[model samples]
Target chain A: MSIDDKNVILEIDGLQTYFYSSEGVAKAVDGASFSLSKGKVLGVVGESGCGKSVTAQSVMRLVPSPPGKIVGGRIMFDGKDLTKLSMAEMRHVRGDRISMIFQEPMTSLNPVFTIGDQLSEMFMLHRGMSRKDALDASVEMLARVQIPAPRARAREYPHQLSGGMRQRAMIAMALSCEPEILIADEPTTALDVTVQAQILDLIIKLKEDFGTAVEMITHDLGVIAETADSVVVMYAGRVVEQADTVELFENTLHPYTRGLLDSTPILGRRTAGKFEKLNEIKGMVPSLYSLPKGCKFQERCPKAMPICSEREPQLTEINDSHAVRCWLHIPH
Target chain B: MGPRERPQFTTMASYILRRVLQGLLVLLAVSFVCFCLFRYTGDPVLMLAGKYATQEEREMVRHAYGLDQPTHIQYIKFLGGALKGEFGKSYVSQVDALDTILERFPATFELALVAILISFAVGVGMGIVVSIWPKGCVSRILMSGSLLGISIPTFLTGILLVMLCSVYLEILPAFGRGDTVQLGPWRTGLLTLDGLKHIILPALTLSSYQLAVMMRLTRAGMREVMGEEYIKTAWAKGLSPAKVILKHALRNVLIPVVTIAGLSFGELIAFSIVTETIFQWPGMGNLLLTSIFETDQPIIVTYIMLTSCIILFINILVDLLYAVLNPKIRYN
Candidate 1:
């Protein structure tokens, strides 16, 4: 599906990554396709292991091997195919052209070094600045991310700071270079709700201030609602639906997307309950390896049809910047 | 701490003082055990003179060394004298124990310092490289080699080095702590200085075991840290692998790595016992071993105290480092 003709900074076509494990070949990103434009937060939402994070990692070429391998894909960044870059070339592109903030805050910053050292080191190595220049830039970056007492905190090691502070430091490091694209892979998963909101806001402001495009990978539909301009709903290693955020919420055609939205615990919306519990999809996500022949997610699709079980439903455009891959949504 | 609080300088000084005091108590307890254990083994004169000492002469020697005093009085006197820079006299050397130890200390220091430096630079560097550069033939070979190094005994490894390097290379010394061809008091014990005139073989003998251990522990620590989310995040941010491994991975890996490195230093002291005996190096290890053989109770006791004191000092330093490396750690 063509996602509105904008300045597509990143476009992935039929990206497939498989893992060779004892169990079987796990297709982590099986023929996943999408495009992300500049200054946009394209939220790719999915459950854990549904290939949302893998999609992001693959774009950055961060997927671990043996069990995970990018067997097929074209990651078009600017004019170059990122997948074809040499190891040395990829290293330069990784933090300079593209930056990724990870899920766990505590695990995303080195515990031994002071926050300042990490941030400054980035400047020193990438920007090739003097130590003093690196330090000044680091302090500025820290302040930009709204860290308390940037100078003092810079000298403080990771363990000395609280969880939220570490996440901010991570963002500061990621944004320090002002890469064109910032890939945040569930960056707030480990944070408390309040801190989560603050971090999200910080990211939005940073992106706006720096004019950086964002490919935000997350499992939370609520977070997507607040931040994403567009949303790609992934199921069983494939994009089930893609649309403008408002359109996706207003007219979600895919059964899986419907289930996810329906399941969100909404307060004051249910008749008898204090909070309306989300309706869980009937069955679990299928194993990536040894999946069903045609539709990997057909087993749990509410509107599953015989055609869906035998032939995978391709994502067909239903409206401007909107698409759905479901037999029910298929036009006769 | 308020501005009115103890000046920062005073606080640091007080902290150091407390640490020293703690070291003293530990030294006392350790010295008592060494005194009791060494004395209980057998009389000093019989071991020293080897059935050559007349009864009166043996008594005279014992009296001179203060061995005739009660155990408690000897301990108090020994502890007091040790605190005041007096390590008592070595009956065999017929010189101040401090002087005799000082004479050998340089050689041992040189051997250990070189070995450890080699271990740290090679082991830690290789570990970080292997972790970041995994999935290659060289990385695999390095990792497996590290595992093998850690599993094998240092002496056996030392022997292997001697066989291959000494017997094969025919350049480095295969065995011997150092040669007796001394240049001056400074070069008395070490191979490089006193015997570099004959140094290579013995230095190799001293360092061989450490190479394996250092490589192995560093690999293990770096590998584990590389797996951490922070390291992955650093890599994703487009930081070069070197920066990621050294700054992000190495820093976090170090507490454990340093622990391993420091513990190896302690192990070096013990391992030197065998290496020193094998090579006949005139270091603390050989001296201690010979004193034990001669049943030189006072000197042996003194030797044990010295080793324990070194260990105690190392432990304190490690604790201080913990505070610096990890802010979560509180000395209070």
Candidate 2:
């Protein structure tokens, strides 16, 4: 639990982001805890509604209101408690120290502005660079992202670019300021398989060059396996398991994590002489409003025990750098 | 041949010519409809010669105004006169109809320009404020106030403003364009300080609905844009919320807003009939209303043609603006 020993760039402790609506308070992120080390990629993998994106938005203080809010959390970034900072103060930290890329490249960019204008604005606003210098930097950043004809591309708008190009332009803008930490929320989800791989490779390559830590949020375990140094598996707005990527994949813990790994369609993994159906986690995801009494995954878990239905389990450390939230992992 | 190639001058020239031709076609159709409608509405001779006039006098009056001809022939003549800027004499004034309309054009333009400016400034400003802190009490008040602006009719608002600001308070002039003041050798006519006082009530009245509409569209657009991934990316880049909203959110929102504002400009010019009549302002709207009452065929036809031409021109300007505001758009 003491992830502070490492050169941690971002440490989130017991973060609780909630959505309060007429229906009820839905704990979108209920007591989630994780740490991202410097110059490393940490993948937070989960199902669609598992609060992975919410956790990332909370870090940026970009949660929508009237329904969504970061009710409780301590997001420590570069020795500053983001939750404690005023909006004005937080603005300094956003896009400067901790930048983010988004899921839908097609829509993430401001369609009205040229890519150069959007990218250069980051430098002008935060770095206080002159328009000429900012634009030059933008073109440079575009080139660094491996864009063909970076100068011309910068002058173009988001819609004019291909999907892959737009996402790269987004990356170019995010990385323009050379941020300390980059949070990419499902950055490749809306792209084709080929484009997705290219974007992922680009991210990993850029992370190396910039030495910026990354929090990669995705439902695809394959992406996590490919890009993550460490991994956090979430279920129902809480971290069900957390471990180094290799360890998490090799020795999968938590029924939800196991279910996710099993569901992945790995090449050449079918049983010999028999056609095997894809494994599906049974039962619908519990609605945020009316979750069950005990373990959230208990109803859908094949190995559910009486204790799972009776009480929720804490995220217990099972080994060095490995944690799981399950009665099975709890010491007697 | 590439997407970023600067378009050839010939291409732009051809595009503009095509647009102009299309606009002329639209104007022709509109003129045809207005000619038929006004001709069939009532007897111009009845209004021109009076009900007690002799049959010969009525016939002479009809022939004098060129209204004795068939509708199609009259339309051809009207189109010919409009093309040459010779809109015949007014039925009541005995002055050239084009001259009368030209005299009123500046006043209407001045009022419409100021009103549109006010609407843009207040609407966009309030929209940004409301959208930024959408759940705050201030935002709620502004949104509710905008709804009130939209709900109230312009004439009612005009009367209320006049009552409060002019009649009761004596702060501003009650009606009419104020007395013209000459500075040096040049007379500003309606732009003088005294003239501005007369404008406040009518301008506010003219822009009430537009102001509300701009605010609502901007607010809705901002609210939607704020949820976009690029906005989240903007914050994550360490941009202050103000910068994110202004530089990132506002630019994107302006696309739809500009469309509304541009289209509404035409509406404001045409619909000022009610506001002008209420205030007794010597604008084109007032002239049109009086001309209609007198069954002034030449003035009425010219006014309709002028308004439609202005609307068509504005539509073309809006289309060109799309390319400037959003680089994705291209005329070619």
Candidate 3:
């Protein structure tokens, strides 16, 4: 995408993940590729089970074992291959240069610890700061996140705080080290609409303040429209469309992408009727284990062709930066 | 008015108070049941008779301890004496019951303490190891071994150890009240440092099964906690596995494991009675056995109440600890 430039901080290519079970393997993420430039936001938009969050985890190599297997991928961050790093080496990158803000903030923070203990640990461990200094920095970070009465709140455990406060605390902790890239895996998915807007604003401000690249993984198309510079649309376990955010919306390269936009009730559009009810995409995201032969989306794609089921399509550039893997978009 | 707030302490406190009151009522029931059963089963007068005693002499002996009184009257007098810290005299030893127990308390406590410590260390350690590597052969073997430990009756285990390690090998003592030839003044053990020589076999017999039970519970606790999203979030934040397990997993897992441990302490007290009878370790277990053998009903009732009370008290402490570790809980 045009948004991902020379300052690219994280790049993932050809990632595949499968969950092993007695019934059969469930391929969670088949092959996906995208990059995030420094100080830019790449929104990964997909329905549930479309492997949007799995791609984010693959970059961090946080996938669980036995059931989860990453058969192919390269998570390139600042010239280093994260997938190849030893467990010890991965530790240095996980919280230092690259951090993650998980969905469901209430469950993300440690329930047994006070907010202060969880926060100070980042400074105490990474910078070898003294306890008092770490504590002060944590309090300062809390204030920066707009938490009211930061000092009093710091002493309270996770359960003591409200939903909005916990989300902010998670963002504050993630930004304390000022990482080069922040992977937010649906940070506001569990929050109410108003709180969701506040959290998104905080993420954007933090990204701009620290020049941190943000990978925003979410299912909400409205969030993508409001903030993302680039967008990657995942279908089943593969990326079906990748382009600059404006271009993806203005001239969508995949039929699935078009269906998603048409389904959303937007404010500006004046249609024939007051507003036709949203046309929900038919059928469910297919089980990844037995994905359609050529295109994972062909089973539901309105423009599905005979060849679409015969062979897998490669991610190919349709324009200077817009990429799509559908046969219909390929140059004939 | 904030969303996702914890319930107020007043509500949780009332719930906890109810639980505690119920526990006390249960203890009272246990006392009554033990008292009735003890009298119905055994002939205290006949058992109180020594190596040289005629039928007329046994009747006179029964009258001396007030066995001649009706059951209800005997209960009231016995209950009254217990309240005054007078356990009455042992029918056979002719010594104050409390004095005999006090003389034996430290020895029993020492053995139980050592066994408890070893149980926690070995059990939790093995549990963590197994959870970390569940598919490995060692995990399977360790977990299976713990189940076997829980199933085997403690007395049988004690007997088997005596036969296998003592009677055949003779490396560990088969039986003795500590190791001294002449029991000396109370200065650590009944017979100086030599008493340790006798404590070894009994302690091992006591620890093995306990260690197995603890290890099983610890493993399950660790597995459940490690699967939590917070743990995965910690990993993605770049925290090493060691920090994740030690700082996060251990503390959180201990909440349930600690309660189980406190409950097990009560079991240790019960198990010791059978264990001490077999191994002769000069603990409260041995004292209870000897007093029972001599049909000292007053002393028997006192010890039973004491054990039940200790259990009740420890369980209350455990519940209080739950509220402390989890601030969401409150005790009245």
Candidate 4:
């Protein structure tokens, strides 16, 4: 398919990211497939170690060698297969065409540099802006992110700023060159609820303004609900379900997605005239090193059937804009 | 970002002053201890007197050199002389002790400077390369080599190098700072081809410890730092590996490496005692060894005091460097 003909900016098909250690290989991301359209946000929702972060790193080509390797994948971004690009070529695509924000705002910034220095680095490195021009642009970007005393804030180091402020600065740095794709790996996870909302709002607003496609990786379902246009539910490095956000939330299909939705506490309305105890998905997430033969979540799946252990399910389209990997959904 | 507050200049000045005062106190304590210890080590009068001297002759020598004075009075006199940069005169040579130490200092300085420069360059370079491909064949080999470097003592390494390079091959001199060969009208006292050749073995021997220390610290620090969220963010920003690792990851790793290096500077000076003796280089280390055997009380005392002062100065420099390297550090 000619990807350029469509609005899809990023497309990952049959992506497999693995970690090879002395003991064994960990299939961190196995056969994951998804596409992000222009100006849309694709939320990759998963528990820790589910390979959402690895998927993001794979796209960025940032995975460390030996221990972590992208053995198989086709990561198409801006009319090029990123996995096939040379290190030098890949560099051109990074920061300029695709930029990423990280989970821990507290530590994501280089502590030794002023926020201004870090922000200006992007403009200077990719855009080839002069030092003064980059500095001016950095201040402008900080102001755009709603930072007060922009010029002064730019001069302050990352440690000097509050967590929320640092995340805002991080966003400013990420969006400095107006990248076509922005990969935010739990950008607000380190912030509190209030700050989380603010960060989420800021990201959404900035995405709207810049028209940048976003791959938002988060464990928090609430964050996905707030910012994601489409959702890819992952478990044990595999995509369990993929759907439009509203449809996925309204008609939660995959057992893992249902478990995630059930566990989150809603703002209002009591069920059966009483506040119900929060639901939790039974059992822990499976280890990536030795995932189960059939469904990775079979042991923890509340609706597991005999057939689940017998055969692994493939992600099959169930309806328009909705797909799920489950034996229950298959017609006998 | 909001209402930025820079660290006030007065606070920085006061902090520097406090550190200087503390350093002075430390120096005073160190000097006092060394003075008291050396006073009881041997009798200067006996060494000054001839083997068949009469009681009157010994007494006269004692009175002349203030050896007959109380310990407190002698200490006060010593302190007064030290303050004026005069350690009176060497007990054996009867020449100015300060001038004697200063003359040999240039040779030692040249050797030490070259050793440290080589150590930093090689160590940091190896560290960055090793960190990038920690488990690769080259990195693993380097890691093991660094381990071996750390395990061997400086003297042993010196001897081995001398045997292999000088004794076995005769490619380079095994000992001495080489015969005089002037480079230019303006000489650094070390800007000579012979000087360079003479310094190689001693400098290499001296740097082995520093190289091992810096390489290990840098590798460990780089490993930890390279895995950080900021590094990944930098890569995602589409920065080249060189840019991401060198520009972003390097600064964070340098904190620990620089700390170890700064602290090791004094150790290097102390270690030169052995390195210089092995090579027979005309440096302070040799002067110190000869003075000890000759019962030159003034030279010994002056060298100890000078070393203490250098250490204190380094500590202050390190503190200032910390403020520069890590903006999180405020002097107050």
lDDT-based ranking: 4, 2, 3, 1
- Candidate ranking under TM-score, highest first, comes to 4, 2, 3, 1
Per-residue lDDT for B48 in model 4? 80
- The residue-level lDDT of candidate 4 at A151 comes to 93
TM-score of chain A of 3: 0.95
Error of 3 at B111 (Å): 1.7
Model 3 chain B lowest lDDT segment of ten:
B181-190
RMSD of each: 4.0, 3.4, 4.2, 3.4
Deviation (Å) of B234 in candidate 4: 1.6
- State TM-scores per candidate: 0.86, 0.89, 0.89, 0.91
lDDT of model 2, residue A296: 93
Q: Write the per-residue lDDT of candidate 3 for residues A203-314, one digit (tens) a residue.
A: 9998999999899998888999888998999888788899889888889878888888888877655565566566777888887667777778888888888998888888
**Isolated chain A TM-score, each model:** 0.96, 0.97, 0.95, 0.96
lDDT digits (tens) for residues A216-300 of candidate 2: 9999998998999999999899999999988898898888899988888867756565578889888888899988888999999
The candidate maximizing lDDT is: 4
Q: Put down candidate 1 lDDT per residue, A1-332, tens digits, no spaces.
A: 44555689899989998878888788888889999988889999988889998888898888886567889979998789988988788878877778989888887787666788888877876799999899999999999999878998887777767888999999999988888999998988899888999999999999999989999998899999999999999988899999999999999899899999988877667766555456898888877766897777788877778887788889889987799888788864
